[model samples]
Target: MKRYYQQEEDIGLFQRMQQDDPLAFEEIYNRYFLKLSNTAFKRLQDREMTEEIVQELFVNLWLKRHRLPELKQPESYLQTLLRNSVIDWFRARARQDGFAAEMLAQPDRQIVNATEQHILYADLQQAYESTIGQLPDKCRQVYALHQQGRSVADIADQLQIAPKTVESHLLKAHQTLRHVLKDYSAVAVALFNFVF
Candidate 1:
């Protein structure tokens, strides 16, 4: 039966993956990556996010392969993982927005004096630099130009890459920054909205 064959195939792949077989793991990735990406993109509508979620899911699958859960349908298992990842991603984004909103709504007792302004600027600068430093070389360059008010097409032209490549770098940089700069949620939200 079809179900029997699927079970046999998945079981073999799962067992092989557990034993650290790269071919088996690659087979699983090829089987599920696009399908999972489609499912995620259908819900998220953001190509970069969809790709990131699928990539992370596969990476996690490999890293935790030896302890992979027992399942009747491996495809279903992957779907569940992707779905959960999407939920978590949205939740974190919402939290970031909420933090920004809260910070904006809070009442300050007095106008910030020069010293306070200087200290605040220093903190923001430190966090911003640290976040930017973590980006890949191409991504960091794209981000720098983008920060200076360059359009995506402009960045691509300057960097001699496609516009889509520019967008991908920016998206990757944004995701990385937003993740590490969690405590500076207001800054993250502002930059996140500015980037894309």
Candidate 2:
């Protein structure tokens, strides 16, 4: 009975996709890609390979849309399928004897460069902090609360200011940061690192 209901839902979604419903594709992609990518990454341990596998999975999924009814839990099924594919790829490379050896012969440049990038990131971060420190007191406070993950409503309530005022302060803070960091590519990276 549960299988029947799931099949019906799958059919509905598949039909919507076939009709070129953008939201359906977006929903399906978002709902599965992260989990599937994580599963692939865990197995492959190569970021580029994992990304390629996940992208290929999405492309294959769309191409095989008519077969959606065969899936039990589409997301889980895709993850398992990707994991098996990664394992098979490793096995095939192992059978080729020198393939793994050649891959291992290359230095892990990305890991090595990441250390220097981290130091540069820290420097840019300090610069951003110093610039933010120069904001007007209320703007600094509002931006600080925002950086702490406080919502505008929560910040307004805590600071005893109107929400519009909190938003205005945040906007002013962002404008200031943009102006201060306009000359550096590191500025965007710094802001993203700080925000996230």
Candidate 3:
């Protein structure tokens, strides 16, 4: 009976969100943010990345409120969205060479032990390197510097470009890489410690 009442309340909040009620959205976010953050953190094991995944989920939820379909269970809907967001992050990480390093640094490394997994990793690694080589000179330069742990301001100063410009280049590089590697994510996410 209490669960049913909570579902009714959640459905009402979803409807209000579609009508642009910031308060309703805040209520939903407040209710779910910690749960979603903890869910993502358990899989990601990285605080910053988990926060990014959860924040982006809420941002997209608010941005696409009007288009969201009616939900019998908003919690389920949010969970599905969070799952996809985590997978998307995995895809982005797979495109970066540092992904290997990050995985290796994990105390309990989930390295590719199976031949099939190794093949997939090798293919993705090659694709990532190729994609990096194909980026526009400026975008590639900004991305390489950023990967080396340079701050946006530092990269901007070194490249004689605005910080915003540096960010723009990095965003472009990431978008391109994500697009190119999207197909491999479902498989890659499963083979790695990204299991939910």
Candidate 4:
């Protein structure tokens, strides 16, 4: 009985999403977003980052709707993806923060063109802002300040709050955006091309 229900739901969602039905996508989001966000938050221990991760994942899933295979268990697949994304996030953070300098210090590093690098950075920034705009008001403001290259102290000063409050808001906003923009590479690339 359980398998039958899962199969039915998966088939319905897959078909509806393939047809570009917004309601179908909403159903999928409503069903999976919070659960996936929670899973990511547990692993990352940062609410804003987790939300952004999950959002990207779902957005990708929607964009790739036509290619999605029939899921044996949709919930399980979402959870697994969240777990993997969180791990990848931490790995990237470590690399960016110089924690993995030894691995990245290879002499054969291929240098990218300055123009292309700038375009990519700008594209990412645009996508990040678009994702942040989808958040609640407070989350959006906090995220925007962070993206504007403001430090926690600066944000606190601007908002007239404690530094810890800024940190907390940033944490929540990051998680929300992560979950909201999960799997957003395709959209980001498209937007990048459009702008550049």
Using all chains and alpha carbons, the TM-scores for the candidates as numbered come to 0.48, 0.41, 0.50, 0.48
List per-candidate RMSD values in Å.
15.2, 12.9, 15.5, 16.6
Model 4: lDDT of residue 49? 91
**Tens-digit lDDT string for candidate 2 (69-112):** 65444544564567556656665755487645665665585456
Candidate 4: where is the Cα deviation over 4 Å? Answer: 1-8, 106-196
**lDDT per residue (tens digit) for residues 43-123 in model 4:** 567888978899999888888887877775576566556666766776587568874565456434423333555776675
| Model 2 clashing-pair count | 0
For residue 15, what is the lDDT in candidate 3? 92
Residue-level lDDT for 106 in candidate 3: 71
In Å, residue 44's CA in model 4 sits off its true spot by: 0.7
Which pairs of residues collide in candidate 2? none
Q: How accurate is candidate 4 locally (lDDT)?
A: 0.67
Winner on lDDT between 1 and 4 is 1
Per-candidate clashes come to 0, 0, 0, 23
Worst 10 residues of 2 by lDDT: 187-196
Q: Which stretches in model 3 have alpha-carbon errors above 4 Å?
A: 1-8, 98-196
Local accuracy by lDDT, each model: 0.73, 0.68, 0.79, 0.67
